[model samples]
Target: MERSKTVRKGTAYWILGVFAIIWAVITLYPFIVTIFSSLKTNDEILGSMLNLPRDPVWHNYYVAITGAKTLHTIMNSIFLAVCSTAGVLLFGSMLAYVISRKKHKYNKIIFTIFLTGIVLPIYATLVPMMKMISKIDILQPNAFYTLILIYIAICLPEGLFIMAGYMRGISRELDEAAIIDGCNTPQLFFRILLPISKPALATSAIITFLACYNEMIFALLFITDKAKYTVSIGLLYFVGKKTTDMGPMFAAIILTTLPMLVFYMLFQEKIQSGLTAGAVKG
Candidate 1:
C-alpha cells in the first residue's frame, strides 16, 4: 500500500510539472515572437513570424529609439509614474492610517465613499473631467500635473484598502509608545508606522506606477505636444496612414516591455507577501 501511494504521488508530481512547462511556453510565446519580430524586416515578419530573421536588422532598434523618440517617451512615462505613485502613497497612507487607527463614528462611511470611487466607471466621468481640465488655467499650461493628479485619485482607493488592512494588523501599543516618547502624530507616522508598512506601500507603489506608465487614453486626450508624449502615445509613431513600420514598431515594443518585465520580476515576491499579509491581518 505504501509503495502504491508513493507511485501515485510521483505520477501526480510529473503531471503537474508537465502542465507548468506547457503554461510557461504559452505565456512566453508572444514575447518570443516580439523579440524575433524586432530583429526581422517587415517582409520577413509578414512572411513568417516563427522563422528566425534571415539577417538580423539591427537598424530597427536604432530607428525605434531615434526616429520614434522611444527613449524620450520612456522618460516621460517614468516621470509620470514616479510622481503619481509618490502622491498616491502619501495621501492614501495618511487616509488609511486615520481610518484604521483612530476612533471615529464616521470612519466606515468615509471608507465606503472611497470604495464607491473604485466601483464607479472612470469612463462615466471622462467628458466632465475633460471640460473641467480645459477650464482650469493651471492645467492649461502643462498636462503632466493634470495626469499625475488623475492617477493619484484613481489609485487612492485600492491603496487605501491595502494600507488600512496592514495598518489594522499593527498593534495599537506602538502608537501609545510613540506618544509617550513625545513623538507627535506626524513623527509617529513618518518614523514608526511608515517604515513598518513597507510591504503594503511597495505593493501600492508598483500597482500605481504600472497604471500611470501604461495609461494611454487619458494621455492621448490630455496631451497634444509631441515632446510630452508617454511611451503608449509614442508607440503610435510607427503607424502611418500609408504603411506601418512593423519591424521598428516591434522593436519599440521590445524596448518598452523590457523595463516593466524586469521591474515585476524583481518585486513579484513583495507583491505576493503584501497581499497575503494584508488579507490575513485585516
Candidate 2:
C-alpha cells in the first residue's frame, strides 16, 4: 500500500512537471516567434510565419538600430530608469523606515496616502496632470526630464509599499543599537539600515526601473520630438496608419527587450531573495 502511494505521488509530480513545461512553452512561443521573425526579410516574414530563416537578414538589426535612432532612445530610457530608480530607492526606503519606526497619527496618515496611490489608476489623473504641467512653462521636447518628477511621483507610492512591508519585519533593536552607537538619524538610516535592507531595495529598484522604462502613455503625451523618444515611443518608427513594417519592427522589439531580459538573468537571485525575504524570520 505504501509503495502504491509513493508511485501515485511520483505520477502526480510527473504530470505537474509536464503541465509546467507546456505552460512555459505556450508563454514563450510568441517571444520565440518574434526573435525568429526579426531575422527574416519583410516578405519572408509575411510569407513564412513559422519557418526558420533560410537566409538570415542580420542587417535588420543594423537598420533598426540606425534608422530608428535606437541608441538615443535606449540611452534616454537608461538615464530615465536609472535616475528614477535611484530616487525611488533612497526616498522610498527612508520614508518607509520613518513611517515604520514611528507610531504616530501623521505617519499613519502619510502611509495611508501612499497606499491610496496603489488603488488609483494613473489615467484618472492624466487630465489634471496635464493641466497642472501646462501652467508651468519649463516643459520642452528637448527637456524631457521635466517629467522626472512625474515619474518619481508615480513610482514612489509602490516603492513605499514594498519597503514599508520589508522595514516592518526589521527589528527595532537594531535601531536602538545604532542609537546607542552615537549614530545620528541620517547615519543610522544610510549606514546601517540601508545596507541591511538591500533585498527590498533591489526589488523596488527593478520594479521601478521597469515601470519607468516601459512607460509609453506619459512619454507619448509629454514628448513629441522623435529625437527625444524612449524605446517605447521608438516603436512607432515601424508603424504607420496604413501598413506596419514587420522585420525591422520585430528586430527593434527584440533589441528593446534584451536589456530587461539580461538584467533579470543577472540579478535573478537577488530578486528571488528579496521576494522571499519575509518567508522566514532571521
Model 2, span 18-88: residue lDDT tens: 99999999999999999999999878887878999879888888888888878678889988889888988
Tell me the tens digit of each residue's lDDT in model 1 across 70-147. Answer: 888999999999999999999999999999999999998999899898788888888988899988888762479999
CA-lDDT, candidates in order: 0.87, 0.82
Please report how far candidate 1 places residue 22 from its true position, in Å. 2.4
User: For candidate 1, which ten residues in a row score worst on lDDT?
Assistant: 273-282
* Cand. 2 TM to true fold: 0.88
- List the candidates' TM-scores in order: 0.90, 0.88
* lDDT value for model 1: 0.87
Which stretches in model 1 have alpha-carbon errors above 4 Å?
Answer: 1-5, 9-13, 236-244, 272-282
